[model samples]
Target: MKYTARRTWPEKSKSWEYLGESESLEEFALAFATDKALEVDTEFVVIEKAGAESEIEFFKVTRTSPYGLVTAAPRVESEGSSTDNATTKDEQSSNDGGDDNYGGVEAIAGAWRGVISNILMFVKAGGAAFLFFLAAIFLAKWLFNAW
Candidate 1:
């Protein structure tokens, strides 16, 4: 799956500007659009392209802070199938009564990434501090022996 990020400034121009593309929506959202742009006058959309079909999802900026803009649930708008024989009974039956849980799984994976990164940072900091303390103790012992 490919995701593309686009933004439009209605006041400036009606045309949408392509920001970039990524393999995941979370990466695209985290890479594009600053807090100021989301707050001021920009409208953002993420285009999800899968095989022959594509989906355009509009994002609503819910919260804007120094970090970035928090988006509400995206409004999904499908562009329809590209091929005539796209729909089949088998496919329809497979999808019937089943909720798409990709978004949920992606969110969980993203949260886990944040937790793991924080843990790695803490470990690195602690290791560095311990090394510094060891070096200080060694230096103190050397100085006492010299005296």
Candidate 2:
């Protein structure tokens, strides 16, 4: 994903200066707010090459989740053709539903990602706790049975 941070100058005529690229959205937002920028505009354009799948990819859901919430994956529009004029929000989500799924594969992928991320964090913390427990047991044995 490419992100450009620009600061606008309001004089007799409005002008914009490109402030280089930002690594993250948080960084871009912070600079826009703190720098007293006149206008902060984000340009979003999705371009697909000659041969690409229009549908979004899905990910498997994690079975053991603390929060029982299914995440949705982001979708890419292969059907919608681009135009010079601005695109409406209504046109974007207006996908002709062929099935009963509330959201397509993208939504499923998102849910799975969330579940996996949580599971990973739990495993990391649990691993550290287990190590500490083993150390305590070893210390206790050494002190009591020092024959």
Which tens-of-lDDT digit does each residue in 1-147 have in candidate 1?
Answer: 566666643322223454566767756665565522555434577677665577666554544554344454543335563243235423653575322353466568888999999999999999999999989888888977633
Span of 10 residues, lowest total lDDT, candidate 1: 8-17
Per-residue C-alpha lDDT of model 2 across residues 53-141, encoded as one tens digit per residue: 42222221223222111223433335444342115423434543323354578678889999999999999999999999988888888
lDDT of each: 0.58, 0.41
- Which runs of model 1 end up more than 4 angstroms from their true locations? 8-13, 40-42, 49-51, 66-147
- Model 1 RMSD in angstroms: 20.0
Tell me how far the alpha carbon of residue 52 in candidate 1 is from the true structure, in angstroms, after superposition.
3.6
In model 1, pairs of residues that clash are none
Instruction: Evaluate model 1: give its TM-score.
Output: 0.33
**TM-score for candidate 2:** 0.30
